[model samples]
Target: MAYVGTFSPNHSLLFSGTKHSLQYPASTRRGVVVVVRAESMTTEKLGIKIEKNPPEEKLTQLGVRKWPKWGCPPSNFPWTYEAKETCYLLEGKVKVTPSGSDESVEIGAGDLVVFPKGMSCTWDVSVGVDKHYNFE
Candidate 1:
């Protein structure tokens, strides 16, 4: 059996089948909060990831500590990330489909998402979007 475990505040493991890999960590030592990306075998190619149901406090703290809050009315548009973007959704829903791929991921309220740089994706806003975003 495979398992994923957190070793410290700064480290985590990625396990698939019988193999294990060490994932990159964002240090929690400097009195700062950071969100680290988790890579799994199946979802690795999308270049966009949504964290697995972050705690309410974590989501609230991210909004309070982030910049440039945005709201978009219900609509659809194609957007390309010029730089790495990490966003926490406070309300609304959206489906992002990468260009040339049939797979899509739905993002909604209380979700923390990371979109990598140069990723070409179309945004399908289903219930509008309200979120706090920051580019890395």
Candidate 2:
């Protein structure tokens, strides 16, 4: 079982397991904790990750606006990443199909996407794309 949880720093408590158990420090009495079960999105197969409608705080933290911008009209092309690439889409839609794999991922505006280094994939742009991208 997998669990995801968030708590305020004011709480001095530890949580363990899917069925969460809380242990508080001797000095602290009680606090509020929120826990949710995690649903896994499998990215290990293609090494491509698409985060849909990521929070503005996450975008700001990644400095997405500071990265270089790239745009392309509706088209299809093959690309291989020499380095890991992270990008935030501002507009348009795209479908990326990895080489030798039938599965494809669709991404569009308000999405944060990551392409692992050495990945070979096809970019099928149905709508023009405008994005800020960074290579690491």
Candidate 3:
């Protein structure tokens, strides 16, 4: 005797090096990160797997990158992404410019910022900078 269910093939385990343990929702009996493939409940039939195929837009799992700048730095122009990002300042200060906004964010050590996904922004780290980030 056995039973079957549905699951998402892809899901964020952890944003960065941050470890995580999965908990079954009240409605769920028990589960794993991935589950057995079933035919009866196709994506449409089960209202799951909404995206047949999504673009591959993967970045570093857990990464730390240092950015330096010259006096009166112009800006740190990077590509906009669809994943929410949090930055931890290790040194220096930076001005984070989010898309659709005129004001920018200035953050320093022990300071964290949650950047909304799909934000177009620039980084202006005064006195150079070092930072650690977690993105899914």
Candidate 4:
């Protein structure tokens, strides 16, 4: 049977990666994107998925004065992964709680910082804030 719209069975298998996935405000959300394949997954037992890259021109066009949030779920937390990220706090504020750390820092507008993969942090998002994000 062909599954549709945000439904994934236990035995379901999806072999693909996101060239780019954009998260919206989520009121009119629809459909299941895809599932991870059994093979080619770096952290199989850990349930990690391999993601594809997005276009450069599109990324470069990312606008400012928006709210963007990055979250690392307890289930998908990377043990030791590293990626250079560009964080431009356009509005409101965000707090990142890194891995193995009990404290977090609040970042507001014009506060630019970088967080590596292994860093575990509970992203505390403000009531209404969205940002244009491009993570490599």
Candidate 5:
């Protein structure tokens, strides 16, 4: 069976067939692992989570089409999220760099992105943006 999960610095979790293994340092308490059988997996960059080209069914489940749309031309600005935000990009490209972080997360058309609550970041919109966004 296929599994989808993410890795942290202290633990390594791997799955094959029906068996799974967790390898962690001795000092830390055991952590929980959540796995999903998905056609696509999510990835993290610059503390932001992104699911590239997520399955169509997943979009439907999120009711992405019903979310409010926001757009902007090429510009750079700092933003802080008071609540968790999830957005589906319908067009354009953006690079978001978290506060004090040099690395940036690049997101574009067809990407599902999640920004954690209280996150402070800079948004550099390079190709304009047309997206449906929801705050949770």
Candidate 6:
């Protein structure tokens, strides 16, 4: 049987479609756009979230304000995060590979990345690095 349901803003299931077909309400007081995807909708899963080559307008909408900046010269180093980290790259290129894994992610300017807490990774800053980061 096909599972159908509506989720609230907090992602809790509000209702399910069984005998009746499911449909979204024509009007909603909330202006936010909601996207619902079934499990394993995408193939890639590397524990890193990236918004690649995002447009300036979308970045602005994400509240990309001037943040405390950090920079480093071209280098390679192993690192581990004590807490979750989110960063918006301002400039440079980087490759991050998870511990005991050969697979790596290429990151550059205009890329938004989230590194999970307690993740052990190696950072390869190829073209130097400059970015704004926040930890949670």
Off by over 4 Å in 6: 1-45
Candidate 6 C-alpha error for residue 101, in Å:
0.6
- Candidate 4: segments with Cα more than 4 A from true spot: 1-82
Quote the positional error of residue 96 for candidate 4 in Å. 1.4
Q: lDDT tens string, model 4, 6-112?
A: 42233232343213333543443345454432321111111122111223332345543343664422222223335545454444455555556666555544344
Q: Which ranges in model 5 have alpha carbons more than 4 Å from their true place?
A: 1-39
RMSD per model, one decimal:
11.6, 8.0, 15.8, 17.6, 11.6, 11.5
Q: Estimate each model's TM-score.
A: 0.62, 0.67, 0.41, 0.36, 0.70, 0.62
Task: Supply the TM-score for candidate 1.
Answer: 0.62
lDDT tens string, model 5, 33-89?
557664666998766899987888899999999999999999999999999999999
Candidate 1, residue 93: CA error in Å? Answer: 0.8
Pick by lDDT: which candidate is best? 5
TM-score of 6: 0.62
Candidate order (lDDT): 5, 2, 6, 1, 3, 4
Top-TM-score candidate index: 5
Give model 4's clash tally. 8
lDDT of 1: 0.71
Look at candidate 6 and tell me the lDDT of residue 31. 50
Candidate 2 lDDT, 20-76, residue by residue in tens = 345767345434445544332324336778876666667789999899999999999
Ranking by TM-score: 5, 2, 6, 1, 3, 4
In angstroms, how far off is 14's CA in candidate 5? 31
Report the poorest 10 consecutive residues by lDDT, candidate 5: 1-10
Expressed as tens digits, the lDDT of each residue in 2-104 for candidate 1 is: 2343343334332333333344435543343333444322233387878745765665676634578999999989999999998877889998999999999
Q: Name the regions of candidate 2 deviating beyond 4 angstroms.
A: 1-45
